[model samples]
Target: MKSLATLRAVSAPALAFVAGFMHAWAIASPLGGQPVWWLQLMALTLLVILLDRCRSATAAAWLGSLFATCSIGGSVWWLYISLHVYGGLSSAMAGLSVLGLSGFLAVYYALAGAVFCRLRPRGPAFRSCLFAAVWLAADLLRATLLTGFPWGVGGYAHIDGPFSALAPWVGVYGIGAAAAFVSALLAAVLVRPAQICGAWQPLLVVVLVVVALGRSHEAQDLERAPAVSVTLLQANIAQEQKFESATGVRDALEWYATQLMAASTALVVAPETAIPLLPDQLPAGYLEKLRSHFATGQRAALIGIPMGRIVEGYTNSVVGLGPGADEYRYDKHHLVPFGEFVPPLFRWFTRMIKIPLGDFESGAVGQSSFQWSGNRFAPNICYEDLFGEELAARFRDKAYAPTVLVNVSNIAWFGNTVAIDQHLQISRMRAREFERPMLRATNTGATAVIDRFGRVTDLLPRHTRGALVAQVQGSKLITAYAWWLSRLGLWPFWVLVAAVLTVAGRASRE
Candidate 1:
């Protein structure tokens, strides 16, 4: 038989590699729009536990760090694609930029690994619980601490799966915690001998129960609400050529108007800044033509445009056309960090990068809803969709919340990169968590309609120019998560983490 030392040394690196590989696949698989990769993560967790059984504390720590770093590094490949291929950055600069970002994010995983090694448990049950707690804490920190970039949370892997039902109760963070719990249980089962009836069996049972509850919640009788037929116009206009000529703007506007001018639509939507020119700057005849086509009482058009005043500076505003122009304007609230407004510290860096009309001011927070065809819609422009709580809370204070959630975006900047797909996935999760149907109209791709349950009913392909028309249903009411935020998951997770830490401390002391 091999010595304990030999087994420990061999297993540690192997387990680390497995963890890295699993994370890589989990992130890549989703971006590629493939099948779920939760099994890969579970397998890696099992391998880690098995290695932990034979390894010393120092070896375990090293292996754990390796696992964490590699897992996060998986996203770096996509980051490279975004910067180099999509963002127009040079090959050398893109490589450097992605490496820097990946290294920074990987540090959180390294810390998780260190904590896991320090809390080495004697019992299989204790070890598994501790692993779940430590990893979850690290994941939470990654999302919360420094303006929180919760981009690749493990729970997102199950976005379309049975576990997605948990979104309404625990939000994405809760789903993430559940994923960690399941992974730990898998680890426990693999590490412990078949005779050991430890926490693994009970934990597996709990996971199943939670999943069943999620499935039931997903299936819970949803009342069929009145549907609103919307026409989403995807004008795949290139940003570089958007402002080159006034004729280009007129041609694009005419194209959208022609496609959506039919009588069946209650409201017609356009992508962000579809009208490249300012409201007043458009050709006088073209503006008149739009007014004549959409002015009738039967239909109203909501078009995204850049509207500005000398007093207010330039703003990315979505204007409602048709009957009353003054009554309906939804300015973009959460502007992108560097794309829309230059950060105070990085203001000087703007000289290096070339972006058209980069400095734009943000709209007032909690602005009034955009009114269209008797429906008050809560508008989320671009990156605002990523802030789940902020978007959900916008509807809470009012007696009657907006009936629909409209996201007007220009994903052309990222081209056909995974950025658009990842963005759509998050939008799907938000729909389930908020229980609101989301209508997205983007410049390049993924202009689609998402139902209240997070299902993508219909979507236009990326890089193609076309119109996607669908009937979308509004929310029945605000979901449980809309009010609770992450509280439903945070309290329970912290309690478990504290208990695990207590046990770990005692074990270390002994």
Candidate 2:
């Protein structure tokens, strides 16, 4: 028989592996073209906490590091498919790049693990809360401090489930905290010596109550919004054809116009690069056609196209057409690293891989709002919506708050991978966090109208060319997340982290 110490040592790593696998599996299962299994994810997390309790600090730390590394590594695999199979990167190079990226991200997870082990509490309740706080702090650090990569947070896995309701109030970090809380609570229950079920029964009640309250709040919030009509057009253009052929642009614009003409929608939108023509170089005949259609009144158009000076290089922009077109020209601020503009160091590496629009420039910083039919529309083109702070900055002052959010994207670069779905989830959370309706127009897939509560009013399927029409509500009132906690619910969370660390330090000394 093995020594008790050996079993204890093995338990931590095994549990950590299970946790990492479950976290990755939960995230991938939904987006990997499989049915979502949330209960399984919860069980796995609980197992990790229980195992951590049995192991030494060193063993727990190692396990946590392993889990963190694997989780990030799995996500990098999806990113590889996006860059390689879809974005046209060389298969070998793309795989290598993604593995490298996964390795880099795994460092953050390792940090989280090391911290969790070092700060592991003596009391069960203290330990659980401390773990949640530390993990959230680590997640916040990951999203901030180096331009941030807020993708693949633990909370994102709960986007479509009952837990999603918490996003508006506490943002993504809150969801993660909730997940951690649940796992810790389960650990406490499972590891109990028995017959003490009555003592811990109140904890379960508290969890149920919190979840119930979250659901109730979501339902009420959903009912509050006054629906506004929106139409999103998706032109299923292939990646190779999008950047190369001018005819593809002409056809896409014509198709979108024809679709808009058939329906009497309030707002009509087309995806990024829907009109491949630059702003100053828009075809005269096409401009006239668009002008004539809007002259009839009561309709506005927002289409994504290439804009800015060719002398300084092109900027990926979303130009609002019709009356609003003259008032608002939203140039995308955040350019994709390798996709839009190449970093100086990586310039030499570009020869090994193929990247579309690898020579584009970034737009000016800060949010630009568009006024349309008695509403302020904020545009987040492509990857700009991923930056939570950037998105919240637009409505920092209530006077300049946008009535709705518009995201124009070309997700065709990622093909049919989970990246598209993951992108949609981020957008959904943003809408709920800001309590603003979001209209997403994309090339290829996931063209959708999202409500203030993050519910999808309507959506177009991936790889399909279609139009989605739905009534999206607009909000002027600032959400708690928008007015208070932008970007992983930062301020309060930081304060909490400081307090937790202080208490943990005192406990360690004692």
Clashes of each: 0, 0
Cα error, residue 160 of model 2, in Å, equals: 4.0
Model 2 lDDT tens row, 1-510:
579767966666676666676676565464353314374357445544644564355555555567766666665466676667755677887878876765566566566556667767655567667777777777787777656776777777776766676776677777777677656656655666452354266456646866876766655533233445778888898876765646666677678778867667777888888887666666668757776677567887887878765776887877666553354578788777777777778787665557655677766655568776667888888867877677887767777788889999987766677667777777887887788888899988778888777777788888888888887668877766787753333778889888988988788778
**TM-scores, one per candidate:** 0.84, 0.87
User: Which consecutive 10 residues in model 2 have the weakest lDDT in total?
Assistant: 218-227
Off by over 4 Å in 2: 1-15, 28-47, 50-61, 86-89, 192-227, 260-263, 280-296, 364-366, 486-489
Error of 1 at 410 (Å): 2.4
Worst 10 residues of 1 by lDDT: 484-493
Residue 505, model 1, lDDT: 84
lDDT of 1 by residue, 74-151 (tens): 643565554555456788887776666656666766666667777767666666667667777777777655555666
- The lDDT of each candidate is 0.69, 0.71
